[model samples]
Target chain A: MSEVLVIVPVYNEAASVLRSTLEGLRPLNHDILLVDDGSSDPVPELVSDLATTVVRHTLNLGQGAALQTGMEYARREGYRFAVHFDADGQHPPEAVDALLDEMQRGEADVVFGSRFIRADNRALIPSFRRGILILGKVFNGLSTGVWMTDAHIGLRAMNRRAIQCINLRENRMAYATELLWQLRHHGLSWKEIPVAVVYTAYSRRKGQSSWNALRIATDILLRLIYR
Target chain B: MTPIQLLLFAALGAIALIYLKLVRYQLGAVVLLGLVLLTGCIAVYAPDLTTLVANRLGVERGTDLLLYTTVIFLCGIFAVVYGRFRKIEEEHTVLFREISLLQEQVRRGGAAT
Candidate 1:
């Protein structure tokens, strides 16, 4: 069992960016789980020989389900640390190591990578995106009572306990907030890291619309009502 | 209660039951069945009750109240079906991913390594 397993949930990502992203993780050489979320593209074929295991979804379930699949696979395969990375080239591959190191220090059960956590990364993030993240922060605070600087960032590393406790139900973008709620509800220890993301034009194109904050909020509200 | 109203209630309830069953969405079937019964009762014995409730709720007419309630009820049912479908999809994804991992291992000569 590897000490750390990286879970990258990808769907129909461009070949060029994925190749670069996979290559970027070569230095850490962590066991990679690339969850192909029912991609139309030949994602599995492209990553077949990338020193990684490809988990295929027959139907497109969405990023949350893909991440859950990857996390469950990591848990089953006996990984001490499991990381959540985006398929798009937004997240920094090496920051995964930083998150795992923080987990190993025994300070936190879960580590979240936040671009707003550091001054330099904050400076790099554009104003338009920061406003959306702040809206997410406010929503998280009001809905889940979990206050954070950034809420939508996918960069995360969790240990076995966190994996066992933080069960995600949301199948899409809303799962990010659901993960935060679960962590807060379970009273699990968590730390934040100042990780920077590339935010390339392609990644930006793939990003969720800021208006989607309404849909995410409604999903959370309904879950709360139905619960 | 008119014979016409009773027939309409029965017909609509039957349609709802059939439609729900056809879809095989059973999560809230019992609740839906209960709603049907309540709707039957309203149609048969207390159709004017809608008017009273509408007055209390500051709505204009009995039909308007029924329409509002029906829309809200449908939305609730929609939410339930949506949630159930999501749960089923997640479970399938989990199973699918597990099988993929197994197949991959076997392809690589598996535990024999």
Candidate 2:
């Protein structure tokens, strides 16, 4: 039995695309937790037969909430570690080992996959998109007073200690910044692993927009003031 | 009434109609209506209300008081909207957990059966 779990938070992704990504990860030898964030489509139905646990939210609570639900389930299931995998066909399935390796190093409790730190893949990150990521990092730093490369990247590996110690409450895009805040609040050790994202035609069409970067900043700023 | 006065009333009437139709909460609708009337009075009788409010509050200008009050009101609205969203989110999370737990129970029960 795989001690590690992969959490894929998806919202309204096409079944074909989601299926292909799940299929690619079959070799990872880890349990999969598919959190369907109140998808209006038949997303859960499409992956019902896969060797994965499908969790559904009755209401659309956004990506952060989905990840929290998945990770919580993983921790409760007695998994040693959990990786935040995107349902979109962006992250390479083979990179799971590199991320899992970092967790096994016993040096850091959390490992974040940073695309900016690795450029080996033929990933085509648009200039404007890269600028938005930098702005997101700046916003995150301003919020939590901690800075890290690829603050907005979705792929991450967290050991049981990290998951058990951190509490995720952000319900939307603000969860990214909230994760960094939790890392600081719990004094958890972390490392950034160089993982090359596979930029595909579908990914370029679907993904967080630049507008969302500003909104994430706004959300985090509001939380800092009111929270 | 003058043509400008008639046009102003028409615009205000249209806004009130839309507000009544769109607002879901009764308390919210009442508060919004009160604000609309307050703004109308401020715009039309600024000198009188401003003078009275400024004298009572010890403010130099009514515009400054209005600006400050507007900022405070906007922040209050932001807090209310954000709090309501958080409340709904938490409740939904509870519901999700209940359903997931039930699903797990049913699976285990089926396996036992």
Q: Mark the regions of model 1 whose C-alpha exceeds 4 Å error after superposition.
A: B1-76, B109-113
* Per-residue accuracy of model 2 over A1-227 as CA lDDT, tens digit each: 58989999888898899999999998878888888888898465798788777777777878898898887787677889989999998999988889998779898989998878756531457778887887787777877877888888889999999989876777888898999999998999888988777767787777877788778877787777666
TM-scores, one per candidate: 0.82, 0.78
Q: What TM-score would candidate 2 get against the native? A: 0.78
lDDT of 2 by residue, B4-110 (tens): 75667677778777777778548977797978666764555444676578769988877777778779988988889888886786777767765864675576578
TM-score between candidate 1 chain A and the true chain A: 0.95
Clashing residue pairs in candidate 1, if any? none
TM-score of chain A, all candidates? 0.95, 0.95
| Model 2 residue A146 CA deviation in Å | 2.2
TM-score of B chain for each model? 0.67, 0.64
What DockQ score does model 2 reach against the true complex?
0.25
